[model samples]
Target: MKDSENAVDIKLIFQFFMCCLVAIVFLSSTYLEFSDYAQFQHKLKNKNWVQKTMEITPQMEIEIFHYRNHQSKIIFKENQQEIFSKSCNGQLELICKYIENHEIQIISLNFYTFLDKNTNNYNEFLLNTIAFKDKQGQLQTFPYMTDAPNSPQYIAEIKTEFRSFFIFAFLKHLIFAIMFLGFNLSFNVFKKSTIKLINNLIITTFSLSFISFVIRYFLL
Candidate 1:
């Protein structure tokens, strides 16, 4: 009877470990998804704000480059540059002054064709918007478009665009620890007759954990 009891306890402990592993994977993957979604929303918000600031025309392409220190550059299409170059600078100055006054950090900006205003091919153009975050966690935006003379292309680096989710990282470990303890306590209630069921559960949990880890770290 003593030996049998010891064996049962050992099996229960192992099963608890398996459950803990599954919970860790589930929580970690959830945190990663949340983090990515937060960043995606942040950028989307900035993009929308920039769209509202400009008069878009179909025949023009625009690009705006900005940095954290309130410095910015605008590239316009050749023909449009002659018309809008001075105004673009003045616009940039106002944007920079506002950012500097409010203590905001300009992370990065993306340029793309927002609207093709002109039905005819001649008036079709691309609109550019700049996105930045202020000290109060508010997004600020501005708009510009490209013309003939200034056809400079600004490629924002993908790696630098995302903000780190340090808080999520820390919470991941804390949740894992709590799950480990919870699983251990829950497994203590199982009977020896349910060992087969527990074993199957362990296998399923492990498989799920492995799949989650692969999807989060490799596939994503």
Candidate 2:
């Protein structure tokens, strides 16, 4: 009888642990999603530009279909047919407009194509993103760039901001305060331990801030 009771207790503990794990995963995922939304909102409020990255493939053929004086126009061909023409304004920073999802979007792209000597086909294409103004008159550059797909340094300014102790500490404190306020308002069970939680959060904030400073100072 005692053995059966012990086994039941262990099983209950295991189930509780699994429940906590699942809750942590759900909460963390939700937090990340909301944080990303908040970041986008902040960018929009600051009139920053959001752009998408694009890559060229060998399937697309390129031709210098038009030239006049100093300006030139290049056309893209796929399957022996011309698809779209990009016009350069005497420079490489050409505005390429394309329809995406039934909406017209503009991107500044510099296109280059090389013919394959062996295959006698234009199999090489290079594309570079250019700094340009968006429809809202916001200057888009590599530093304030967002939506750079697969880029390692996406919005790297955030990391650069963290290098400043004031910004890092302030942001950490703000995040913890928000989390504490949220828990205090939403969960009744957290009421009694509110003071304890606040103290712990304060300690954690300082500890993390100091660690960040130390690591950046010594290692980075």
- Residue clash pairs of candidate 2: none
Query: What lDDT score is found at residue 53 in candidate 1?
Result: 32
Tally clashes: model 2.
Answer: 0
Please list the residue runs of candidate 2 whose C-alpha ends up more than 4 Å from where it truly belongs after superposition: 50-220
Candidate 2: tens digits of C-alpha lDDT, residues 1-220: 9798777667666765665565456545544644564454344334323333443356765565444575566566778787556564433324322121222233344433444457876532334354445656665642322334223364354445444644544555455545444444443344557757765775676467446545643332
The 0-to-1 C-alpha lDDT of every candidate, in the order given, reads 0.49, 0.48
User: Which ten-residue region of model 1 has the weakest summed lDDT?
Assistant: 148-157
- Per-residue CA lDDT of candidate 1, range 24-125, in tens? 676668666656754544343343222223333455545555657755754445355632322325546665555446565554444442232345222212
Model 1 alpha-carbon miss at residue 156, Å: 9.3
Each model's number of backbone clashes? 20, 0
Per-residue lDDT, model 1, residue 187, is 59
What does candidate 2 score on TM? 0.28
